[model samples]
Target: MPPIRYRVQANGPLRGTAVIQGAKNAALPMIGAALLASSGQTVLRNVPTITDVANAVELARAVGAHVEHHPADRLLIIDASTVTSPLLPGDLTRRFRGSVLFLSSLLYRCGEVIYEGAGGCNLGTRGLDWHYRGLVRLGARIEEKAGTIHITLGATAAADLYLDTPSHTGTENLMIAAATTPGRTVIENAALEPEVVDVARFLTAMGAHIDGAGTGRITVEGVDQLHATDYTVMPDRIDAGVLCMAAGITGGTVQLVGGDVLDAFGVARHKLEQMGVTLRPEGAVTTASRLGDLHPINIITDTHPGFATDLQPPLMALATQASGTSYIRERIHDARYALASELTKLGASIVIEGERATVIGATELRGDTVTAHDLRTGVSLILAGLVAHGETVIENGRMIERGHADLVARLRALGAHISREELPDTTRP
Candidate 1:
């Protein structure tokens, strides 16, 4: 088939609830970590039915693990007891970037893993040097010969490893790698992303000793073994943030359901409040509504307890509707503003210069055809369409489906006029 497209027609505010899916970022690494358990079945609840998760399940099966994915019930049961492979499926691994997360688990289980290919979103150069160096510090022998990552597990567990940039995946890799080793593993400069903390909790529930999850420093005491555990992935905080922005930009009132009452998106909630958005976090759900007009708010993406880089796209879409110019400084990835020009197609006043972009708001956005380059930008385009004056068709919509499940249907349930359409495969013979 051709690239899937989303045709969204919007004329007013959205209503109803958005059921938050499990964090894709957290689930992928967690799926990889399942292999660390030598026996029993690992049950992951609230699993998001997205392409990335499906790819992860395929990766698990390719490695000789039995994975039963129940999208109807949002559950993934992984049986790694029968794992017999040390090589990640190159085709599958090359298709999804998170596949690299399996390296540590394979090293923990099989003592060696050879992966020749790794791919994901084109977020410029997210250096894997931090991961390689951190793993090496943890006593793993890592070598790249002929473009394949060859990791040989050290006989002894890593004592202390420090991440140079507090990379989210790197931190999780070290934590999972250290889980079964027989020593106390200390990770300084650990990523404080909420998903990282959730994965740490999941490992902890699986009998690994971990502490300082939400802080920059983490300690993981290795145990003799890890058993299968039933755990639920945390709600996708970025998804929750997108909905919150959806409400804010469209003058809509939406209650983001099944979240941790805005705890994970604490920084985003504050940022939205600064933009005159009314967000109330009570109990399990966080309700986001309008507080008159949106005001300008400048933000910079930083490590957790700070604004999230993933939220930048949708929030950038939100800024286009704010009353004044809202400045955003992206310190995470350089090429993330690929969506900025697409936003300009919708009549957004956005001037991007390198890592800094000035989004002048209170400008009326007229819907136009746009392309989504990545998962976050695809959803961001959808949010922009929800408030645009006319029909907005987003091409490359498969990018969004990679991370979000039933997004159009969910948004439709909220009274947002949107539908999915399959583009004719023009490249087929």
Candidate 2:
């Protein structure tokens, strides 16, 4: 197979209903938690069919666990009872940073593991100091040997630990570390993302006592053992936002089937409403469109309950249609402003000053070939293509497919004229 690129033309509007898949961020950690089950078959329902999930299955299988993925059914089965390794596969582990979450299970089960540098989106310097330092505080011994960090779990029972940054994986790794450790552990300043809550629920279903998952503080009570059971992953809020932005860019109405409007989007839902985007609430489903001219609004990205940085890319695409200047402050990430450069190729007038970006919109955008630097950036370019004039081609969609499920198929279902084709890789390693 060759490298994939999406060719999109302005086909009028994106008007239809599409069901969003399970959250990738949520599924990754929950898959890790499945390894904590001492016995029995751990079944996960509504798992997203993406490359990252497939790689995670390989990661699990590499550790000696029996893993099965049923993409047609969107389910995953893991039998970690047979897991017999402590070294995580470096090749697959480096593909995505969430691979670090697997360490919690190895430490809790095997009591020791060796790992090296983690990898993920090219956002500058996502420090694991919060994860590593937090784990060490909970009685785990850490040794740095020949560029690899060797972690040996000496004791599990602990009182409380606090994350200075509320890292999502930090909360999860700690939760799994405490799950079978024989005592209650309290975590302060925990990540408030919905994915973090879902992982906590999965652990609770496996007989771990957990409280305050969606809040800033969380408590986990260790159990003597964990048994495999059936679990469901949460819906992808980022995908729902992308669909909504897709509709907004094309000036059409699209109903996001199975979108958790309130829980997932949080502050973003209200911001879309404030921007003259018509949002009709219908239980877990909502329809979005922009009949009137969109108004620009100020947005600041932060942790959960605030405007998410993950949504910033698509929202930036949406801002191009707004009638006035849109002020966006990217406080959470340093290099996320990279998209402004790519969007500029399509006639978007954007200027990045430090962590802030000013999008001068209502600009006439024409399609051209663009590059995708990361997952959200790829989605952002596709969103721009939906409304662009003439033809737009996005190169190197590997990262996009890694995060989203059936992106081109889902968009085509909504009446958009988009086709994905594979082209030979022109660059050499």
Candidate 3:
């Protein structure tokens, strides 16, 4: 497969309406659970055409699900009715971190799991020690060597699984494992992100006993079988936030529909309001713009109900154009500030001190070549490029599509100077 690269041109004040897709952060684990559901078909609607989804589809196939993707229709039908085993292809698992989700789902179905180390963003050490510890507490035996995790379920029963920290995926993996273990499972200090609630809703619809989703404590009463059902996932809040920020940073008016403000970004919405951005009530379209001549304010990242780590990169891009120094602290992912080097390429003054970042607002940015280290970083480069005075070509855009769908076309509709570009040669010398 050819690696897709984007050559985003600078054209803003970007302005246009965009409907958010089903949350990628939420959809992956739900798709993973489809693997362990009773022998039946599950249809996931509003699926995004991102690399992460592709990885999930690959996971479905590896675990014996008949997976079909209709990108044009935005539907991914996964038929796991005939799943015969818990063994996932190690090669496919190595490509993405979402693969670790199979650990819990497989343990539910097969009582054993052997898989490769999960991989994703290289921000910092993504140790699965917490996940392993949680699983062990739930009575699963674990053996590891050479980057592969071998798990065998012992006396399956519910237990109190306290997250060393409420690691988002860690809590999720534990939830999936405990959902069918025939006993009550209590998870404390669990991640309460909207995505977590979405998964819980899906599991409950499938007959799992889960309570207190989106709260610090969650209870799951294990059941023997989960039924198949059609589900519409919640809107992508991060995508909505990015588009809204794009509108504000470029001084354009755009009404974003199909998203609930309080459900996904309530905390960020409050912060945006503090910075003078207005968000209409539920079912009302929202718009973004500058608060007079002075820039709004500074922000720091945290877990859910705080400025999202996912939105911090683009927020930094927007902050660069603000009038005052904006402080961004990433409490979740430390290495998310890799974009500072690329932002510097565009003549933005951003200083990084460990996990914290400070952006000295700039009135103008000059276009330059930049590399996207990850998904959000790639989109941030596009946002900065759009606000620049000249053309900007973003290389290695594969990172962008790993999360956002139709990003180039959406920017194009918003009057961004952007287009997909092919590399010079398909064959290596």
Query: Each model's TM-score, in the order given?
Result: 0.97, 0.97, 0.95
Candidate 1 structure quality by residue, lDDT tens digits, 15-133:
78889888999999999999988899999999999999998999999989999999989999999998888999688997788998998888888888988777878899887877777
**Steric collisions counted per model:** 0, 0, 1
Q: Which pairs clash in model 1? A: none
Residues 281-374 of candidate 3 have per-residue lDDT tens digits of 5574666655454364667777888778888888888888877788888887767888999999889998889878888876578888889888
Collision pairs in model 3: 9-417
Which ten contiguous residues of candidate 1 have the minimum total lDDT? 259-268
lDDT of candidate 2 over 8-114, digit per residue (tens): 88888788888888999899998888998878999999899988898889889988899989998999989999988988867878888888889888887788987
Off by over 4 Å in 1: none
Residue 99 alpha-carbon offset, candidate 3, angstroms: 1.3
lDDT of predicted model 1: 0.88
Report the C-alpha displacement of residue 85, candidate 3, in angstroms: 3.5
Note the Cα lDDT for every prediction shown.
0.88, 0.86, 0.80
Q: Indicate the residue-level lDDT of 393 in model 1.
A: 93
